[model samples]
Target chain A: MKFLEPGLIALDVEAADGAAAIRAAGQLLVDAGAAESRYIDAMVASFEEKGPYFVLAPQIALPHAKPEDGVKEASVSLVRLREPVVFGHAKNDPVALVFALGASSSEEHITMLRKLTTLLNNPAHVQQLKDAPTPEAIGQLLEATTN
Target chain B: MKIICVCGLGQGTSLILRMNVENVLKDLGVSADVDHMDVSSASGTQADYIITNNELAQSLQGHAAKIVIVNNYFDLEEIKSSLQEVL
Candidate 1:
């Protein structure tokens, strides 16, 4: 699975809350032809229904709904927030990085996540992601780390 | 031991948790059949332990399987310690 495509990343973006963050992140997927426009709202609705489960870790969120919701292909989007937004997660709240995933199948989702597990499970990589200054830096980090 | 990883959609986060849990289990040399499922499918399924996020854990109360709530799906240390409790 491909990481954040060129132009699919937004750095220092502004989001009022988790929903807005999700929308901003999901729009990247839509704009890249990875998902339909409805996929964005579906992700927000999923968050509203499931609470903060989308907040995967501290300062990180993987907002996604089901594939049937509107995903056209498997892709990922990254948004580094200028200001953190609360997702109501007690342990992993006030997210600064939103990773909106669009996977068209469970197999594709797992393949993408397996690579992410290697990237996200490491604290050093997590810190690099948090401290990344630009989208290109984030892209470089992912390229070097995940595979 | 049988383990079930559940999320609302059954595919996204739960699958990530399952992957981490599997790694933790491997590291501990513990053998188990770990499965991932949707919240609705989880109701009918039975396992030695049910691992999920806090919100889904609430709805899974009174289940036959012991419930394990994990705050961060990517935290293997947290997962290992949590599994150590019941295993």
Candidate 2:
């Protein structure tokens, strides 16, 4: 029941800009075999087309593209940036955490999203995730969140 | 009550907003049927309220449902205060 794997998790990654951060997150999905390389391009295109609407919370972002964008599996990659980067979101700027979603279908994405929503709704759990020391710690935090 | 959370992609951020809204409603002891939809399908959908970000709020103009612009999608207090006026 683990949506995040240690290999796909990056803590305090350094990026030049928001796009770089997104690319780094997308790379995790690529490395995990969840998504193809074009999926990263699609994510960037989606961000350009949709603006900062992907910033779901004050310090969190959920970047994704259409399922047709080249998803090979249903999963998500977690990226914690060393320094927050701005994605033009007026209210929620300088995002520190990025959750890149890659799903083979809408249903798969929705199912994963429901679990994510439950985990993120609790501020305490979110703080735990943000302050997690290692990828193992992050995985443990997510494990505690699963019902 | 019926509420539809709208976002550009619908499945990603909208789902989170919908979850948050549902939690707020439950805390208020109110019953509601909440749904999530993309911006493309949102305008034609039927609902009492359409919750979305400030950007999409403008995009959904002239829609049937009352638009609720939620700036901070995760801010339960802001969402509660805004829903208080309408719900």
lDDT measured at residue B25 in model 2 versus the true structure, 0 to 100: 96
For candidate 1, give the lDDT of residue A129: 75
Candidate 2 local lDDT, B63-83, one digit each (tens): 889998888776789899999
The candidate scoring highest on TM-score is: 1
lDDT string, candidate 2, A1-147, tens digits: 226789889999998877888899999999888889999999998898878788888889889887788888888899999999999988889899998988555576667877888787778988988889999998888777865
lDDT at A97 for candidate 1? 85
Q: Where does candidate 2 clash, by residue pair? A: none
Which stretches of candidate 2 lie above 4 Å from their native place?
Answer: A106-108
Model 1: residues >4 Å from true position, as ranges?
none
Query: What overall lDDT goes with each candidate model?
Result: 0.87, 0.85
